[model samples]
Target: MSLQDWTEAELGIHGRVLPVMQAPDAVLSAASSPVDPADPETVRLAADLVATMRVSPGCVGLAASQVGVARHVFAVDVSGHPKARTVHGTFVLCNAVVEEATRNEKGREGCMSVPDLTGDVKRASRIAVRGRLPGSGEEVVVETDAFEARALQHEVDHCDGYLFLDRVAGAHAVYARQTYL
Candidate 1:
């Protein structure tokens, strides 16, 4: 299927996400991102996100803001974890927020932006998320594991103009693909 003629569509090359957001400034928000489980636009975006996820081997998720749209939206495919792979998920969330960050820990992380280089960053192990599901128009709260939780937190940061690198507390711990960072 030909991709939608989205007015704000953009691409992330390598691991570097386009329009990477910064720290604290866009960390959080109260905006209610809405979705019409029946809306064509929502479905289109979800399909588009899936297609992107499949073709882009490195992209576990992508947020709308990374494409220059401020709307609260993101897609995640959590097959990377062996536990999640048995029956993993490719899902969407709109205007999602972490109601609480449980189990704070510093873990090494990377991004679709700031490709090649990764740093140890602090993240919540569990997040109680509230958002609208694509094509469902239903608002649901998903309490997910650390990996899935981290993925959502990463994308949500983009919507608010924050990037994973900003979450790096101290000097970076271990560096991977330093050429890209």
Candidate 2:
């Protein structure tokens, strides 16, 4: 999607989080994009994020940036319960925000672009996210934490040009454990 030239039709996204690095960069702004709820391109992007989530290793979610767009969007599917069916509740969230975030929790995280690094990062314990479902004016809010919270915080950062590597608490906390792929 051409953030500079693409119109509302050619580019499915209004604005994406990532720029040129295959995925979105960390975002700082907390504003949502104006998406036409009924546009097919918008719907397809959301579905693309969801599909990417399923195929990515060590990935529970994906933001628009990861897909090389710079809008305010992402997708997540972690219905596995950490033990059961690891791929269940697939979701596509567009123009998203955290209405209310509380406390702080730290955990290990990795990005598709930052392939060599996976490290511990701090995030909110509980976050209430609000965003419009593609092609629909109806807005939906999801309360998430744990891995979900980590994923939401991580994706939201892409909107403002922030990266998990920046959030690494210390050198000891960050790791280049493996090149699994």
Candidate 3:
């Protein structure tokens, strides 16, 4: 089955697909706070984040702040991207951080919140991410490369209140991805 199909088959989602907060929304610009990974609320938020991201066409990730919640939590799934070299399936992470990173590489990236633009942002080609798994409170360390690394960095940046535009190489590095296919 495709990633979209997997995303569509909700296992335990209850809350609605939260709105994708756009630019200029203070929530999207402010750093998010950490949450208890074991909290029921966090689990629900994860469900909503994953659902919302899956529903958004071409969205591979979504952060809590983008859903109007200022929490250090996000969901990512890059099972079927052409550029992906490492895949993590679908996962919800809380209190996530990049523990280690290396190999700077510039790549085009877009966000669900910043739908109007795409930018060529410099990011680590390989990254080691640490985070709490929602509902279980278990800590996970993911070492990934290629597009998966880029996706994790993008979502983590959102947790830190930084968007792709903020990391764009230059004005010329930004582009209109309105026709992203």
Highest-scoring model, TM-score? 3
Q: Write the per-residue lDDT of candidate 2 for residues 29-140, one digit (tens) a residue.
A: 2234546645776666666665566666666667666666556766766565473232325566677778898989777787776777788987887788887666553578
Backbone collisions counted per model: 12, 27, 0
Residue 41 lDDT in candidate 3: 88
Q: How close is candidate 3 to the true structure, as a TM-score?
A: 0.91
In model 2, where do residues sit more than 4 Å from their true spots? 1-34, 81-88, 179-181
The lDDT per prediction is 0.61, 0.63, 0.86
Q: Write the per-residue lDDT of candidate 1 for residues 1-181, one digit (tens) a residue.
A: 1112212222221222344432232323323254454466655665565565556656777776554445667777776664342213666777677898888877767765566668887788877878766655567776777677787788778666677666777564747754534
The best candidate by lDDT is 3
State every prediction's TM-score relative to the real structure.
Answer: 0.71, 0.73, 0.91
Give the C-alpha miss distance for residue 88 in model 2, angstroms: 8.3
State the RMSD for candidate 3. 3.6
Determine which window of 10 residues in candidate 2 has minimal summed lDDT: 1-10
Please identify model 1 stretches exceeding 4 Å from their true place.
1-39, 82-88, 174-181
Local error of candidate 3 at 132, Å? 0.4
Error of 2 at 133 (Å): 0.7
